[model samples]
Target: MHLLKIHGSGDARLDDYQRPEAGPNDVIVKMKNCGICGSDLTYIKIGGIPTPGTITALGHEGSGEIMEVGSAVDGINVGDRVIVNPMQTPSNIGSGGPEGAFTEELLVREARLGMSILPIPAGIPYEIAAMCEPLAVAMHGVNRAELKAGDKAVVFGCGPIGLGMVLWLVDRGIDVVALDLAAERRERALALGAQAALDPTQIDLRAELAKLHGEVPSYGRVGVGTDAFIDAAGAPNILSEVVAIAKYHSRMVITAAHMKPIEFPAGRMLTSEMTITTAMGYPTEMPDVIAAMPRLQDKIASMISHRLPLSQVLDGLKIAATPESCKVMINIDEE
Candidate 1:
């Protein structure tokens, strides 16, 4: 097997590696498409996630085809197209750890059967199927927000996850305002389905939010408030800003992976009765994401701005880190 293993900070190499033999109930899969998530970039730039020296192999947003099924593997077939739920891996290390799906071939044990491995419809492209993980994540965020139809949501970031939220919010008939610092991202957000994409720095966020309604309330509540506020940028001061802009009783969800403790303004939240919550990895989203695949394909595909073979993964990482890039897919089986 050939895998990209992280040795230390700023050190990852595609090297020949050994994979364990499949057990009676194990399945082996050949990697087809894998996405380089924001977390993957964070892991690379900051040594490792959680702590340095913890992660060995790094990549989890991946899709593949079963090449061989164990003798005891009954329900699964060798040719089935599948997505590996990295969360259910036996070691339970999460993505970007030693047991992730970054290799040419992966050995999946039965322990992960119904929980982690999901079979997608055959016609779905590997590139789109590779996005199942992130889409699921966005769905989880939406679920946490619990916004109703016709309510408005302000997504404070236009990265893959933020844009994904826009897709779902619009699909569900929730008006969406996508905010980002990048012009390209803002445009992409609008194209994907945001009612509007605004440069947060260019516009008065408070004023703009207030305008969403008729006008800023003259007393008590002063700004244009939103029903749901999502912070996906993980930028410094994002939490505080969202707290400030949040409307009374608005639901705010933090989907960004903040590396540090956030200092939220307790008074701001208390005054308006704003409910702030955090969402981690997706819990129940696969079915919905898969069901909406046809409608989401174009926008999801547009986010894949760059593709690279496993040999040039280092270069791919560089491209992925740039502001101009969106989702960067790595084709593992490219020869």
Candidate 2:
């Protein structure tokens, strides 16, 4: 089978690998579409994710049809269209060390055993299904923030992950100010239903947030002030600002999954009585992540800004990294 293999740092190519035999709990799926993730950049630039041994395979975002199921598999059909829960594969090491979803086929457990959530339904397109994993990341960030209705959230970074975080919050009827330096992503966030898209470079969040919600009284928890602040850009020096922008009891959820050194202002952290929470990749979001598919059917498909065939995977990967496109997917059917 054809798959992406990283021979070394700054090296990745389409290579052939022996297909895995179906395990008792495993299911094999023919790939339809999979997304090029932001984190994949790290893998391509640096041979592997931080804290890792060496593995040949990579790619977790996948969606397609169930080709074959192990003898133990049941309650799923051979032709069911599906979206793979990226949580399917785990990082034996930390920070995406073992996450490799880009492939022509998928082997996963039938149940919640891993992050693989299947059966996306024929009505749903693989493009959107491929995003289930990231949306779940956004959802997890929202949950970690411990939100209540009418809460104000400032989502930093409007990339797919960041934009998805804003969408989930908006879907829950929360007020969100999406912060991003990219113009296209900001536009997509608004189109997908973010309350407001603010360019961090143009407008001052402190001024705007205060203007919108009265004086930035103190950040709140559950409700009041800026309840939740999620940073998806993984920028290095904004934790303190996030804390300062947030009300006193606010919770800051870091969802970038970025593996970089960041400065945390302990003095402010201690003074603000704030909470910092880190969301690892979909630790427990599989079931709901699957269930969320149909609910977000319309919004999901519309969220796609570009689609290309597998032959253009290289270009697609490049575009997905650029600010010009919100989400770029590859169709594996091209021969």
For this target, which candidate reaches the highest lDDT against the unseen true structure?
A: 1
Q: Which residues of candidate 2, in runs, are more than 4 Å off?
A: 23-25, 49-55, 89-100, 109-117, 216-224
Residue-level lDDT for 101 in candidate 2? 50
- Per-model TM-score, in order, reads 0.94, 0.87
Each candidate's number of clashing pairs is 2, 13
User: Judged by TM-score, which candidate is best?
Assistant: 1
| Tens-digit per-residue lDDT, 1-335, candidate 1 | 77776667887677787988888977888889888888877776767655786546777888899998889877888888898887777644225445657788887766355566788765789989999898889989988999989988889888889888998898899989999988888888888888889988898887777766433342375545578888888877877887776666778899998878878798777656778898988877877898889766887898788888887888888887887788889988884
Candidate 2 overall lDDT versus native:
0.70
Q: Would you give me the overall lDDT of model 1? A: 0.80
Q: What is the lDDT, from 0 to 100, of the residue 325 in candidate 1? A: 81
